[model samples]
Target: MSENNCIQYINCHCYMTIQSLQIKARMFSRISLISLIMIPVIWSQDWQVQYSSMMKCALKGSNTHLSGSYKHPNHLTMIKTFWIVNPVKGEETINLVDHPDYKGRVQYSQNKDGIFFLSLSNVTHKDEGMYCLRIVAKEDKYLFFPGIDLKVTELRVEIPEEAVEGKSSILFCKTTCHLSDKTNFTWFKNSKRLSESNVSDQLLLPSVSTDDTGNYSCAVTDHKHLSSPAVTLSVRYPPKSVSVSISPSEIVEGDSVTLICSSDSNPPALNFSWFKENQSSAVGCGQSFIISSFNSSHSGRYYCEAQNKYGSQRSASVSLTSAGDQKAVLYAAAAIGAMLICICIFIVVKKNIRKTGDAGGQSGVSKQEENNSTAVTDQTSAKPPKPADLNESVYASITHSRPREQQRDGDEDEVQYATVQHHRNTRNTTAEDGCQNGNSVSAGSNTEKADDSNVIYSSIKSS
Candidate 1:
């Protein structure tokens, strides 16, 4: 061979070696990647099987199961031959074949892929124990899985023995199972859900009252399990909405009255008292106060108080009045009216008497004038009588009894005269005066006309 041909052969040989190295390297990389992926999968399956051996908690009177498995793809031919159950305390070991008594309660199944499961129906506290599984292969070899512990749990609620009305209270929800942080709690009152959202395990009440008294229960949202039974909360409180009720609302004096004190309380009211307006002390003590004969003394604003061991409350005040007082006021008003009427009558009578006296005086004066006009008087008239001596004077008796004649005289001017009797001096026709002559005389005089005058006199001498 020539030098170039030898060089070409050497290049071809080197190219073939390089190509073979590349192919081998690529294959090795593919295999390494596949191996890396398989190692983790295998490791995860082993981890799951090992983790399944840990203790498990389940609620009593509920269905539960224990599961076991061998390495994933490699153990495809593996089969669960039997199941063993170990109880917590006694030497009672249970197997699938030997425990005929547990045939109905215990269930076992193994998948074609080597996944094994054991289920217990209506699990009770007595079923708490460790469970183990046995795997059998076609090689006549057996693989014993680690034991798994089974724990029975129960839900319970804890609350205070007693709660006070208008006071804060707390209730707690608990369970025997180990709960995760994501677990949510729910509360129910009288079998009614309080809220739709998840809440804390503890229930807090800012204030409680008689309305809050009911059956309360709690449950876990994740487990969909409730507490065994509901608990009843008792709220103790004082009297509330106190009031006083009176029978025969329309009251009258001298009538019997009944008063009742009413209040709402938890334990019931032990004492009741009645009070009147403006008084600080109670007037009576009892749930019912009776007034045998109500009178003005009982007419006033009244209220009642109800009390118990916890506290006391006062009722609204009510007013009462007697009818006798109204009647008395009316009678007094009538008496005052009568006295006023009498006073008015006296004033009217006094005014009338004064008017009558003035009229009578005027009438009496007119009557006296009329009597004088009808009267007639006669007396001896001596015209121009000189001074007469006592011996020469003569006295005569004169009388006129006809009043009609005196009035009939057309020229007569009626003159009224009183009768006079006198003795005059002899020188004087009139005899001067009776007293001067020292003689008693009677005389009368009347004038019929302006120029005519008639006078009459009568005289008597003293012995």
Candidate 2:
């Protein structure tokens, strides 16, 4: 009776066990699927503060706004909310508004949308750091780690230490943080727009020159109002526009003269040399060249050379004349005038002389040259003038002798005299000097003569 019952029971029990195993496996699969879906929902609902931007680049000296939204378990009530920087004080939540560094510069605000905001004015380099939001609740306080990385920066112009003409140089527009690669830069020089290229953060100068010297600044294209301070850029160059200046416009012999050298360059040309035209050597070296006593030696075309570390330049020449040259011209004129005066005097004296015919009074005649003859004809038959008459007459006399080769020691010398010019007929009148060897006076005739007076006689020296 027990064997049939035992076998049936064992068969029913094995079937039941197999059915239970399949149902349990199905239930376990359902539970795992539910857990996988529910875990993310629970994690998403955990206490978390998320900012609008994970990283921000704010312009210095400008105001910036940062917003954050938070979610937590509904059972917890928020008691306070605040902002702070990294290296936070764990025990003391330092109030940003009360911080000496942030006082008067930080503001806290909230909106009906449950969005919390932090407004910072007059941002500065000191404000650059990681920022976090703290939510204080009745049961606990929460801080979101790996918070906002804020960068407060301004444009800055960085140039090569030495800027030289005719050389390449690069100027950088820099910021505290690296901006987006697509960000464009603007440049200004002397308060005017300098570069038109907007893709590069650097200004490239293929060749530097004095024209590039000026106050330079840079800015981001989007934040033009947040530009950097102007920096002076000096481009060095050699001396140029060299020129010479004279103190006195007029120059003369024995007068002092000064020559000045000047030029245009990045650095002033300190070394100056003066040279004369057609001369290779320098006459002097200095900004000024002085000739204490001007003379012919100093009269010439002069120029100056200005030199600096970069290069040298020569100035246009200026010419000068000595007064001695003027004096020489004056002397030549005086000599020519004297010679003309002597010639005029000799012509007058020769015209006044009368030529007597011979020593013997045989129809004695005075031979004389004439343009218009004023000669008195000799009257051989007329009586001679009285000695008293001769004494009152104006007359001049000169001694004439033959050439030394023909003259004997005892030979009589001929005497020529100039008589007063008058309208009259008169015999030969011979006036003899002490050297005349007994020349006879004219015993010849004389006609009634007009008063012989007021005749201007000129002297003729023997040639």
Candidate 3:
């Protein structure tokens, strides 16, 4: 036949074979419209005779009833039969049992019922795939049944390695499906289930701490199925018991101050820094910090911070002012200035009194001297051309009482003359004419003489 006629013939044969198999399948089993079908129909005509053989078989579950069909126009005989499995698309291919004795052979059987027994132990996921029942006859073809789909359930959990103390933390356990649907969920801490509610997707520790640290796992089961790969939760925080204080609760200019930062932490702080308001400055990791000569520049809202492997924490800010020193200095200066002024005033008053006293004393001395000189002149004039003896007698008594009486006398001539006579007589008279003769002078004369001398001397001194 021509190529076209031959192609038409093969097509006709394949269509008739499929139609016959469908009719037979309908009569044998009650299948749904969506049920898959596999049929064997040969297209080549190489005229050969072979024995039928079973090459591979894949059965799902415990049911080993394998059902498929193949057709051949030529006579064939049954030979050795062996089981094998089809290769998967994305996984490694395993070599199933092969039957060399049944190679290039065909199979013929009177048993039309499609059922075969297979070992249940040999059934596995790797054995799952499209399986074929090969029949070597006048034409070689295969009866195929698509492999069954296998599903696996795995349990997975996610949680943070570290958590802040006293903070609510969540431990999540996720699965392919809801635990209530087909599986039971059991949360474990150190291998103890903590499932009390329907919430199996998460395990909650309202407040977490280092004491809560341990290996955590979820026991997820679907009937007899179980999963592995538990999770570990390491509850940790940056630190606790953070504290801060300011040295010299009172601050002043030109004074050294410090800020102390301390805390209880594991994996001690690595970065210690200071901040004023929002501005940050690098600092050493110490409990106390010293800032020499604190000033207004150092005055502001101050704070400290500590950091560790977990995280960082900041202390409350303390406000500082450096105006104290300025105020103190101003007060001291005012006090000193007042003291100095008082000292100066005292010194001035004392000096003025001494000068006044000295002037008064000098004036008095000069007045006395003048009075004595004036008295001498007067006495010399009054004595006249009398005898030196008489003059001496009068002057002698005058000189004796003049010193006592001169200060009381107010007359200038009498006092001056008497003073002169007194000096002359003291020089002229001898001590032998003492009391008796001196008393002979008049009391009025003596008194008047002394008063005049005092007045003249005082007047001259005053001028």
Candidate 4:
């Protein structure tokens, strides 16, 4: 061949080879794309299944539905199965299907839309384990589907044994997992269904009494389980009827008194405290509290409280008063009695002096009395002045009486006259003979007689 023809032929041959290589690359790319579209993509066995953490089974029910979706292509047929593996038995697989080795039942179904559904029936705790689904196609190899961890939860509830009256009580009804779906929680009291509210953690009792106390329980069901643990509700609080009594109903100031606080309640009393109205500090405690000396400070409305673990109860108030008025009355009575005694003593002494003529006539007489008596009795013998006129004569005698020293000197002679005058006055006699002698002579005679008699009496008594 010519040199130019040879070069053109080589170039044409190289171009044909390049075109063949391009066609082959396109064919390989088409095949790879077809394979990618047709082959079932096996998800990792670590695929996660979305479900509630808590799975509960009824005692008599046959099936618990579990739902999930395969992550692979829709054309792939997924086969799901559940295995009850005993970890204690060296991971021994216990078939949960219609197999005789299984103690529970497990069934599965795939919808036309490729959604997978599973049912576990008569399941126990041993039936709970890791579940896996395998997917395969007519033209491709088998691939592992997602895995679901199954947990069997039991119902549980807790409540306090007792709650205080008029207080809020928490009734706990919780599931092993938070129920995200529709759930119903019901409370029962003594077998009667209680009205339940949503989103409330406490059973608020605005005011509770004895009638509100009873056995209580809670049941939580999420279209799955029912009947939780039962709890006893005991409402305890301070006594209802409280009263206080004072030892002396009538309290008096300066007198010691005791106040008693009493009430009826459960959970025996812890303390008894007394308080006065509007006072911040408590007075005392115990059934009886003593006031050393009741005073105005102690007076006022007083009340007491009986307290216990449950709560405190208050007693009715008792009024206290001071005894100042009553004491004053008693003091006045005492003063009157003393004054009467003094008056009586004065009267007795005065009468005795007049009867015995103890007062010396000279010193006992007044000057005005002596002047009047002298004027009236001048015409008379002045024979110690008749007693009927003694009133006047006594005045004269008083007027003529001597000084204390002179009277002492004349007392010996005047004593008899004074006695005669006293006797005449007692007899109410006006005759001058009543006295019989002149005043001085009579006085001397009576004075000697009186001295002799006194001496005789003294001698006899001593003997």
Candidate that would win on lDDT: 2
Q: Which pairs clash in the backbone of model 2?
A: 382-445, 383-445, 383-446
lDDT value, residue 401 of candidate 2: 28
Q: In angstroms, how far off is 320's CA in candidate 4?
A: 20
Measured on C-alpha atoms, candidate 1 has an lDDT of 0.69
Instruction: Summing lDDT over every window of 10 consecutive residues in candidate 3, give the lowest-scoring window.
Output: 454-463
Query: Candidate 2, after superposition: displacement of residue 291 in Å?
Result: 2.0
Give one digit per residue, the lDDT tens place, for model 3 in 44-94. 232221212223332222112333333334454544332334544465333
TM-score of each: 0.49, 0.53, 0.31, 0.39
User: Per-residue lDDT for 195-304 in model 4, tens only?
Assistant: 64543323555566677777665565332234555666666777668888888766666788988887877766768998989999997878788998887766688899
Candidate 3 Cα lDDT to native:
0.54
Q: Please, what are the lDDT tens digits per residue for candidate 2 over residues 247-329?
A: 67767878999999989986889999999989879999999999999888877899999999989999999877765675677
Select the stronger candidate by TM-score from 1 and 2.
2
List model 1 lDDT by residue over 1-463, tens digit each.
Answer: 9999999999999999999999999999777545433411323333233325467777667777777665534645644356776633345445755676566887777779766788887778877766765445554433233367788877677888778988999988878877556767788899888877648788887898788899889877655564557988889999999988887777787889998999998789989999998998989999998999998888888899999999999999977777677667778999999999999999999989977885686467556644553352222343434664432334443233333323443555334444333332333434456456685533332311121222343433211
Better candidate by TM-score, 3 or 4: 4
Can you tell me which runs of candidate 2 are displaced by over 4 Å? 1-57, 67-80, 86-90, 94-117, 149-151, 180-182, 324-463
On TM-score, the candidate that comes out on top is 2
TM-score: model 2 vs. ground truth: 0.53
Could you tell me the lDDT of residue 165 within candidate 1? Answer: 88
